[model samples]
Target chain A: MGLIGGSYAKALRRLGVKKIIGVDTDGKVLRQAQEQAVIDEALCGAGPGLQAADVVICSVYPASTLDFVKSAVPFLKSDVLITDATGIKGSLPEDVQRLLTGRMEFIAGHPMAGRQGSGLGMSQAEIFDGANYIVVPAAFNSSGAIEWLSSFAGAIGCGQVVQVDAVEHDRIIAYTSNLPHALAVALINSASYNENTKYFIAGSFRDGTRVADINPYLWSDLFLANRENVLQELAAFSQQLERWREALTVADAQALQEMMREAAVKRKDLY
Target chain B: MGLIGGSYAKALRRLGVKKIIGVDTDGKVLRQAQEQAVIDEALCGAGPGLQAADVVICSVYPASTLDFVKSAVPFLKSDVLITDATGIKGSLPEDVQRLLTGRMEFIAGHPMAGRQGSGLGMSQAEIFDGANYIVVPAAFNSSGAIEWLSSFAGAIGCGQVVQVDAVEHDRIIAYTSNLPHALAVALINSASYNENTKYFIAGSFRDGTRVADINPYLWSDLFLANRENVLQELAAFSQQLERWREALTVADAQALQEMMREAAVKRKDLY
Candidate 1:
């Protein structure tokens, strides 16, 4: 459990969620959350407290998410709906829904919100304010469940609720999220920085590579899990980059300015 | 004159400079600056008003810096010291110094400060408060003159003042400013963003691509003027991006994680 888990607890609480049960392997963090009133019942793992949970929000690193759910399944109520805060859906929606198979409901969600810092210490409910919540629905999920999840997201401070299929979710995320991370990481790594590097730093370099200081463990999994889409976006980005290279190579001032203008328009409109 | 020119006027005013002579071909803008107290004197192109100046800070687009200096030469006092706020040094220092040839002092300074928005409306002295001011010195420059320019930058609210030659200045800026702008423009161009793009937008994408809303006229000149160094940095960045692409292609999670960790460390250290 990290920033996402702690944030979900806070946001859910704001939605008047009663008897918030926090589950984490780290008993120390769980105890701290309980003391801070982030959650009412802090569980070391899945316990009898989960039996009363109408909704199970599984927030973990992508790699550990499936295992956590499988272990908790026996303790969850049969009517409980499980929603995940995974960055990339990949096959999580399908695999988890298949495993549940009418035993419970699973609707995967990716809250398009985060900060540079990670861990529960950095978490806050306000990160979700004006953020988009992507609902990745499996075939097994009822429309009613999806509708309820959308409203749940809105109630928890999300501004937009978008329901996309797992494939579309992964594809969209690969472009908007993963590709930007890859670029940020690559851009930062490309620098041959000495102590003098900081003296030359400005807004462009600072903001452009801010995401390079990432949770390596989580992001690497996100990159690999959505490999196909990430690779495609990377290729597209490379081609666009090559256009800049070609223009600079020939010192084509007019062509360079035109390309930059188009990009400026796109960026302004998109953002 | 654009953001850099207006900002220099503002900063020099903050330093208690009694007279801020604003120069521009745009007569209306000059008059507006005078009216708004941004300038003590508004000179249309080169005027007799420039004869009383001790120092001239030439803040124009990189492409026009040389021409502006040439036109202003006759009007400027022979003992006057001149500096520029061009993002790229290129041959500006050498060319300007050679042209002046003891007629006036020429010291090039690139205050590594900017915003996404351009023009006089967005100019502020606070932009330089913690910004790096890179002094690009030519072979003919006096040690005392360089030292004074460093202090001048400090007086104008800039933080660190780094003295580097024209070649080194161009090289460092290619890495820091030009490369990041190239990545931002390329990243924005890579996306086929529809109206739905706004819904998917998050901090990482937003911040990373913020500079994509560039001043095409200014940045294209910066990129082309510093073409060789910019191209070199772009190649290095492409190679770094290729590493991410390769790790994803094979679905190598551990390799990806290691690369990301290295990037995270570098980013943390450099920033």
Candidate 2:
């Protein structure tokens, strides 16, 4: 019904959306979602059973996004504005746009925030507080749908609304999200030693690699689906690494100091 | 004084080693350190300017550690066990052992604990709480000096005293400290955007590259002095980055997934 789909079902219903239904393949999660009174109805399949709602928001793994969209295409209201809450976008937006083919307005949305811990239990109406809601528009998008999506993003308490194409969104996220995650994974990999050696590590090590502890299954899907852009960013990163190596290899203290100085100054400017 | 000379001064005075004197070049810092009453007396110069003591500890940057030791060799108490508090060992130990030849015992010491903040303001008697202190001995080192250094590390609350050679200490630190710092700098340098872009950056960006906000003067010296070992580790990291790039290039979902899985498992093992 709204951004996270299930958790805000009651709130959306109170706000007078006609009917609320939660569709999840996992029976346990579906029952738990309903038992929480977050949704008025629950269903297992994404077929005609989900057709009555004025809008539909899908939140699932990036790898299965297209498959889910294809399955739900026929059942949606003909004029329904379909949206998604996936991390990456390239394949899903293209596939969904083709499958629906102007029958419904397909708008892509991503809430640019989440915590270390996430799931149905951790879901909240306030989760989008002060967050930015990114609106990604595909080729078949209507400007009216964009305005409504922006309003939805605002109603959910998103502090900012950004507009970008799916391709551009994926590319920028490759630097902002994927690259940082990969770096964290690499840093933590080097610290897997015997217990004694690990005990000597400090808060800096713990804080530096905390992202490595995220759920692996979701991350693997996100990484592979965003592979092209992630790789491009990694190539840029490798060249940056080489510059550091060159500065270190020749014992060029001044050059190394300058680079580090610039980095420190730029970083402090973020304050 | 303690493991790194100043801690030894604080501990020895508490142990009734009367008239403790500190030696350092920074007059302002030394004056501040003295005002804190961590040391009974403070000398902001080389050893010839100070009165004789029961023991002398040299705590200086790694590159100048040997020079400081050589300067102190001629003026220490005849039986004084001269030790150091430098991070790396390979070249510094050799230089000290060569210079002090037979006149005094040169036992290299490293206190593995440190505060995120540096200098006298952050110094404390409990600075080495539950920390590992390594006592490195070269071929010509005296056994009595090693025993004395171990006791010194213990006096400063170094939880464990590990005995090692200079080469081993440097090798391990190449991976643990220097390489990690280089990686942080490289990651920070990968982007050239200004403060606006960084403002939208969440915890992941800050956490991944926080170490880039280090003292450039000190780090430049460290990277230059440990050039060879840092280069070797950088090469290894570059190879890993290349492997990740290859996985992305062919859209090899399985390879990328396996890489993430292996890294995740390895990282999880550290906890």
Candidate 3:
């Protein structure tokens, strides 16, 4: 059980989801989850237990998620619902729905809740509190399945349940999540790379660069999965930064102040 | 009095600096400072009473700071020490020290503490409790003046007292303060400017763009005053971001992950 899986298990338990069975490839992780009571039942792989499961949630790396779904399809019960907590949804949701069309339903969900730390030790049920939960439904998804997932998200303490198409979800996430993470990494790398430079940092720099402390393996997969949208956002951000750079070069005080004022006014509505 | 001036007055009072006389162009602000006990006395302009003060601290906008120093010089005592709490050095420190050398010392200081809100209503003495206080000494500053300013910074509840040359101070602050603000503003402007987009914001986006909600008039002056250094930082940040963008474009997952890992390791030392 990793951080996302363990956190989902804990949240499911809190919502009175009995008989929570966790399946992971690692035996040590299964044993740890069992000892911590994060799961009532732990399985090394998909087995007969999957036939009895009404709904299966896959929380894995972005690239591995589709493979996990494909492997579990053979063992899943007929008419079962399959969902995932993956950051980027390229065409996987539609592909999975096509693979299991008549037998089951597949919907993609992304919980905007996580810590910089990883593994089961860092997971907690309350991490989902006041966080957004986004559900992406393809054409094959039924209305009843979407309703059930939305209500389940509410039960698990998600402050908001947002429904959007997969393409729109990935596009918005490229700006809101991926862009910020990329900027933080770039900002951190842009520093002087000397120990003494750290002493000059203040709260703004610390807050601006917090996401630079990231899990590289997971983020690289997310970035590659949604390369086009992320690239578009990167281009937009660089263009805006260049505008400010030009303003500063010419000492265009009016242009600089106007940009700051507009940003200040727009940022107020975010909170 | 405004936010920074009122906060400094309150902090000085906490350190038992008796008879704090505040001078402001606005009479209403002066009356508010007097009513809130932020200052023992408040005056609308530089008066004859300034000749009796042992030290004078000017907390004003960057462009107006030099003019304020020039006006107060004629009424100051022979050995009075003058310091300013301005965001940018802007050659004003050297000019002021040159004008008053062998008569009074002008040490430029910048307290790295402020709130998003303005005016005396939002001022609090505890704002400086754990914040940094930078003392930028010019060529003409005496060792005794630097020593006194450092002790005074500690007395006023500053956690760290950093001493740096005026040029070095501006260069570092361009990275630590100005660049972050510029990035924040650019990020906010780069958004689609749609109200619906705000719903997708999470902790990272909020933290990365918090400084976007800044006072335009004040920040414009700071940016123009230190244009060269800020442009240099902007150029460096753009170059780093371009590197990441190129990595993402080629689907070079290994290169992207390596950069992220290096940033994560470097960010750990900031805390």
Candidate 4:
């Protein structure tokens, strides 16, 4: 059992995946992971780090994931189960499957938990506690592959296992993650560089704009890759903003109150 | 000395005001204040609370702060300085000046620091720590009143103190607090909410919508009371959201990235 991956390697080791092989492009990160005992064995190579492994999980960058999967296809043991921790699924599943010459099964998976501060040092095994694990398995994928993927997530203490079609997975994430990222980025940009303006910021501004500190390079690729669904979600958000603007324009106190009251009640009910 | 008059009470106590009396409409709150030693004596009655008060400071709700000031004006001792802790300064300052037909001087003040959860339970002598205390003294106000108000805020541990006009204070708050609150409420209301849809919500959704749980009644009054400036700020925010929509519409990756990048920088740099 080789846990050659990113931050999730730390979690896997904590879950009793003893023979973990840590892999990263960054030498500093590999050493840090070793110091933190996030991985038992460390490996960094031009090829995928999973050699003679029963199961191989890739937790690489979102853009390079499918490419990594393709490069690693020849090195994996015959009939080895491969999975990912990428946010999007549709394209990766198709591309990796085609690249593998019909030998390996790629199960697209996402752990619905991450801290803003990325990399292994910040990774914690407890991040999976009460978090959702979404699996987007292709149609031709084996039930064995799906079961193993679920078990992998469960072993790391994911609270719930969710399965959705590849297309649906991408669409939901376009709305859930991509669109919110865009909004945060836009809102933060509008403020620009103003020294005098920040003094008045309270907890709401801090909390609401927390995600704006994300790596834009990663987000830009994800947004463009999942373009259609993200565009739809963005339009929906605009429509909502317009409704709010209309209420504010007419000084419709009652409408504003109703909107806020409904949201307050519903939001208060959420964990 | 009256602690309820304004934030000056804390400072006055630190300056050895001796025999500080706390007055609030809530009897339980008054008793709690007394029990906690926030005041030397806690008076539930307005008449009894005003007795021998060398300085009267009003820290009431923004809308009715004027009425509170006027009602207490008659009982105030000669040469007693009047100040306030209301966020809005324009209306209150005028009312305080008009209603107080005595030798007492009126100075408007606002302490710009508070927790999300307000009221006496979260209140403390340390609430003013590292907070800005704005002293909006009236045009006819004597230097003595202004100095006393500054001393009051300083005594309460407010690190930064400044003076501004009533209109300026209201406009600034309308931009800072009211605009942000309205934007947050609108965003949360616009999100897709259903039993199944919520299953996909991650940290982004929870953090983005946390402020939606705020009290609508309190905020409704706040927005409506500061209708002019809040409406102006709402227009500015609407324009910003429109820019975001336009960027999304064209799938302008560079534009979106720039926006997000700026926002990220501003959020990160915010002190």
Candidate 5:
């Protein structure tokens, strides 16, 4: 398991779940999980380990998440409920709806919490503490299924459980999650960086670009999967940047002060 | 005295300086700082209080820094070593040099450290712990003065003391400091923000936009003071942002991942 999956496994273990069957391509992580008691068993990929699972939490990249569901559907109990911790929900709800058979159900979710690093070593049961969990309920999903997923999120320490449609979820995520990552990447890759930059980096530079140290494969897939919304949010943000450029170019002190004041008020209000 | 000035006062007190004199327009803050023993004495303005000082630290906005130095120049202590905590060094070195009386020295410095909020209420001596201290040496400054300022920064808990000229300081800070603050303000004021968006602010959004809760009066002047360099860095940042937009539009996952990987490497290298 990776960061998200391993964390779910760890948090579930802390909850004293009857059994946690961890799966990962890395044999060492699985073995470590078993030895550390974070999991009772370990599997290399989706297999019979999922057969006894009443509820499966798919914590993988968007495409791999769908792939895992398709592979595990055959082995899972007919009435098992499934939810995901994918970064993007674009096209997932419809794809899952078409792939499902019998009584299987899939709810899409996005956890609004993450650390800079990845892998099981960075995983923590408390990562979800005071985090926002966005649950995307599709047309076929029942209230009962949604409630189960919501309560599960709450038990795992998510402070806010927000319900929104898949489209809205992607849109909000493009602004809140994906846009920030994209900007962080762009900032870290900017041409202004030079040899002496290391000595100049402070909290603003450090915090603003912390997510630039991202897992490329996962983020590449997520960004492409939700390309349009990301571009749209980028355009909105570009417009905002242009406001700053214009204000600076003209040396309009009053305009600059007013804009900064508005942003300060908005930022303070967000909390 | 605001956050920076008050913090220096607190830090100097922690260092057991013989006397700590604070000045501010806000009478309430002056009284609070005096009663808290953070400053041994408080003055409403740069009047007689600066007459006895061996070193004067002007922690005000860029323009106000010049004004304060000019106003305090008329006071005694002709041998005073003046340094500032201004965000931008554009035009400051020459301006201070032109304003200096006989035997006075001004060494422009920036503390590559800050926290959210301002005012003496938020001041802390340990804020500079392990922070980088940038000392911008003007033509008029002597090596002895720079050494004294560097050691003072060390005594206040800066981990790294770097030296750069005023113009270079502005250029580097445009990237390290100004660009980040501008980006943060723009992100917070983006059009996508709606009433429900508050539920989505997580570590990425929160950390990325943390500086948006800034001091408008201070930042607006700083941004304009370093307008050319700030604009140049913004252009560089915009170009990088356009790379993301183009890659996403063309569905170029390979390019996207490659750029992200490079950013990850660069970000990791910064440490």
Candidate 6:
């Protein structure tokens, strides 16, 4: 089981979800989750139990999420509600909804909770505590499905459950999540790779670059999936940096101080 | 009483220093430090007590540090050891050494410790605990003076006392300290200034941009004083970020992953 899936299973189990079934390609991971009581049953693929379930939550990579949903469509019960925990939604929700038609409902969800480390061993139910959960509801989705997902999120200890359209979700996430990760990676790479340089790193450098220690495969997929938004945000950040660079180059103390002061005041308001 | 000076006084008091005479322009701040037992005596300006002191540590702004040191030159005893806690060296150490040639010794020091908040109210002796203490030894400095400073650093609870030349110290700090602060400010300003955007900021965003809430006047002086080094580091960082932008633009998943993975591995080593 992956970190997000395992965490979901643990949270669901704590909420007394009856007979939770985990699906994973890796048998060893599935067995580990079962042994840890994160899941009651482990299935390599969709089975008869899938058709009997009232709700199915798919936690998979963004690249494979659409395919996973498509494959699971035939095995779902007529009244079953389906949701996904993918980072980038794009048009996947619309595509999945089109495929399901009148058979099932699909609401796209993203749990803005993660650890630098991954895998079943790193999963904890408390990871969701004080975290933000976003639910992207398409025009075709029913209000009842949205309400149910909101209640589920609250029960799992999510501090906030924000409802927004898929387009807005991707746009905001590009700024709040993807852009920061990109900056962290860039900051880390910018440093000269030497033991001497490592010795001098202090608290700010460590905290500022923490996200650089990322799951590359997962992040790359997420970045490419939301390519347009990420690029736009990246360009905006670069332009912001360029303004500071200009001030520094010209030795404009007043301009530099004003910019830093404004940022400081704004940042203080956020916290 | 400023944060760094007040913290040093607090730590020195705990170490049973016989007396710590604090010189400040503001009488209220000096009184506050005196009332807090952070200093044994507080003066509005240079007094007879300053000349009587065996050692003096100038904790003032970089622009004012040289002037402060110069003003104290006449009051100091021939054997008195002089040092400063200035953010930027920028030939200040050389100038001060030249001014006090054969009369006193000036060793530049930087305490790698700070809080987002300022003033004596936020000062704690424990701020120095497990923090780095860098001593920039000048060519004119004696081994005995360096040894004395090292012991002083250890007594104040500095986890490590690193010895380096002034040039090396400034060069490394440009990358380790100044660049991170610059990036943080730029990152904070990069976000669209809106209430909705503020609400979406999470842990990584908060941590990555914490230093953006900076003392602008202090930072501006530091940046300008170390303009050449800061600009060089900033340029290097921009080049590094540009490489990532290129990789992302072409959708080079493998290259992106490799960059992230390398940064992650290197960052892991630091902790």
Residue-level lDDT tens digits of model 2 in B1-271: 2224556566565666667777777777677667877676667666664437666677766677667766776776666667777767776776776776445667887777554335666556575767778888888777888898888778767777888787867766666667666666666777634444552455667676777767677678877767788787777766667767786777676776666666666556656
The lowest-lDDT stretch of 10 consecutive residues in candidate 4 chain B is B1-10
Better of 3 and 6 by lDDT: 3
The candidate 2 chain B region of ten consecutive residues with least summed lDDT is: B192-201
**For residues B1-271, what per-residue lDDT tens digits would candidate 5 score against the true structure?**
6888888998998889999889888999999998999999888887877898999888987778878877888884888888889878877877887888888888889789887888888989888999999999988789999999899999999999999988888899999998988888899899998778889878889888999988888888888889999999999999999899889989999999999899999998988
Top of the candidates by TM-score: 5
Total backbone collisions for each predicted model: 0, 3, 1, 6, 0, 0
lDDT of 6: 0.83
The digit string of per-residue lDDT tens for model 3 on A175-197 reads 98899899888888995446766
Off by over 4 Å in 6: A14-18, A101-103, B101-103, B191-193
How much lDDT does candidate 5 score? Answer: 0.87
> Cα deviation in Å at residue B80, candidate 3?
2.2
RMSD each, Å: 1.7, 5.4, 2.1, 4.1, 1.3, 2.1
Using DockQ as the measure, which candidate wins?
Answer: 5
- Put the candidates in lDDT order, highest first: 5, 3, 1, 6, 2, 4
Native contact fraction, candidates in order: 0.84, 0.43, 0.75, 0.51, 0.90, 0.67
The residue ranges of model 1 lying beyond 4 angstroms of the native Cα positions read: A101-103, B101-103
Question: Candidate 6 has which clashing residue pairs, if any?
Answer: none
Off by over 4 Å in 2: A1-23, A30-57, A69-83, A91-106, A111-163, A187-209, A213-216, B1-22, B34-40, B47-57, B73-83, B97-105, B111-135, B140-163, B191-196
List per-prediction Cα lDDT, in the order shown: 0.84, 0.70, 0.85, 0.69, 0.87, 0.83
Each model's chain A TM-score: 0.96, 0.85, 0.96, 0.90, 0.97, 0.95
lDDT of 1 at A183: 84
Q: Is the docking of candidate 2 incorrect, acceptable, medium or high quality?
A: acceptable
Candidate 4 vs 5: which has more TM-score: 5
- Total clashing pairs in model 1: 0
List, residue by residue over A129-239, the lDDT tens digit for candidate 4. 778889898887899999889888888888788899888888888766776666666555553325655555555666667788876666666677787787677667767
Indicate whether candidate 2 or candidate 5 has the larger DockQ: 5
CAPRI band for model 5: high
Output the better candidate (3/5) by TM-score: 5
